[model samples]
Target: MKQCLHFLHTALFARAEELLAKRIIDGDPLAYFLQGQLYFEEGWYDEALAQFEKIKEMDFQALYQLGVMYYDGLGTKEDPEKGVEYMKIIINSNSPKARHLKYAAAYNLGRSYFEGCGVKHSDKEAERLWIIAADHGNPKASVKAQSTLGMFYSTSNPKDLKKAFFWHSEACGNGSLESQGILGVMYLYGQGIRQNTKAALECLKEAAERGNIYAQGHLVEYYYKRKFYTKAAAFARRIAENDNIDMLAKITDCLPVYIAKGVAMATFYLARCLQLGVGIQQDQAAAKNYYSRVSVSLQVHSVLLLVLPIDWINKFVSICRR
Candidate 1:
């Protein structure tokens, strides 16, 4: 039985199925559960339900799936009330097998309450259930619960910002991309924790690597501000590849005006990338055009400083040349 389960875990589905078939012939309940899971994945919900129902003593996980099927109208009529009842049973169960099931059951029941699905809508009740699930040692439920709590406390009093920070931090540690991005912003601004630019950059970089678009945007700005042109250009090119009209407009507009340091630097880095072909195809003509604009701006700034001492003017010109 353990070998069969190991095979299933390793994705040797054919051998696992054959082993499960033999176990089912021998009336093994665990085999029925495993077979039901396979059928469910295959979208043969009717067969899955049949196998699940044949177990004389259904474990909480199997029961939870039955509840999901009823609620989702898979091989059964939509019956949210019945679904709620089954979920409650798992939550109330004392069996050690109910350990993980309880977390899922609590989360699902919380959603039911929050959405008024077979239950009265009650924000307080929903929050309570989610908290229970969060403390139940399931990473997925913990992420959901922490994210909800973080958002809830974020809009409250200053005192609650700390609470929000704690929840977001917890979720971020659990690999929640949204929480990671939010935590990065929080750290950047010192919202709930001490301002730590290094920490903020690390969090934003991790989130960006995980495909968080908001984090990517922040990282692009961060690298640009620090004059890490190569890094900034790489990120900017990625964003440009996405072809977001609003973002492209923002990037391009920065080139003609000194609206913000980060934006201006990003524009400069992008132009430099075009010039040097660093992480992008080089276009000398386009690069020269951008460089001309920069040179003109510097020349105008030097003219403004002409009223200064001769030494100052010479120093300024030398700086510009460099």
Candidate 2:
């Protein structure tokens, strides 16, 4: 019965694909959108770009896809300026077809302003755009803007912890994995929220179980602080050595900037454990290697020029001195 169902599903999917291809030949914009999304998900960036560009004038969704592809340099030379322009076009639009996409485009535009990718760095502009997106938050798709608002508030000059907490809570409730981990930290630190150790642990554990690398990093710190060196070592070992510099370089699109901090924390904690022989079998030489890598990661990932948390380098200085 299972095999029959699987076969039926496959047959149905193939038929749909055939119809989609036919519609593409017929110049159906929606068909091009569907096919382009399929290609995007499958990592066929060039084909996806081609399909989206074909319907760019007719669909805001296709324009969004084109912006993302150019922004990420998936199928073309990295052109953040062009991507930013595309997003801006969507935001200025009043077409009903663009209503659903305005929030997404605003969020991406905010990021560009924040990072100075195509525009001069402007926290004011970033906040404005993020607010536009966050105001339109929903269970689907708007969580990123919500979570980003939380991050922005947390780091804003004179920091609005209350706003940060509120946004993170909203994002977490809406099923944002990143916000879930951040909520744990806020709870643990009593940052704009009451301290609740039990809630903190539960939130961190749940987020970690769901494969949130950010939560995993903090979990390592939590265990290490509690003297659960074995568990900390086990987790930090995996996180610290998980080398995906390529992804790290281009991580700005969908991930929080704090992700670099998380990776660095895990690496630092792992190095500390190795130096002291606290958990895993330690080699002083290997510890030194990780220690050096921490600094290198702080410098750059070499692809998209992402610097892994240089702000936390002071934490490693004492360890290096020893």
**Model 1: colliding residue pairs:** none
lDDT of 1: 0.68
- Tens-digit lDDT string for candidate 1 (146-200): 6666766775444477878888888777767767877887899798899998899
Question: What is the TM-score of candidate 2?
Answer: 0.80
Q: Tell me the TM-score of model 1.
A: 0.63
Estimate the TM-score of every prediction: 0.63, 0.80
Error of model 2, residue 121, in angstroms = 3.6
The reply for model 1, stretches above 4 Å from the true place, is 1-12, 72-78, 136-141, 155-159, 221-233, 236-322
Which residue segments of model 2 deviate by more than 4 Å? 1-17, 25-29, 77-81, 245-257, 280-283, 301-315
Residues 1-322 of candidate 2 have per-residue lDDT tens digits of: 9999999977876787799999988977688799888878768799889989888998899999899889889999999988999999999998999989988999999999999998799999999998888884566557788999998898798899999999998888988888898899889878899999999989989987876777788888889989999999889988887567448435423263456556767888888898889988878998898888777766653321232334345567666676
lDDT of 1 at 185: 72
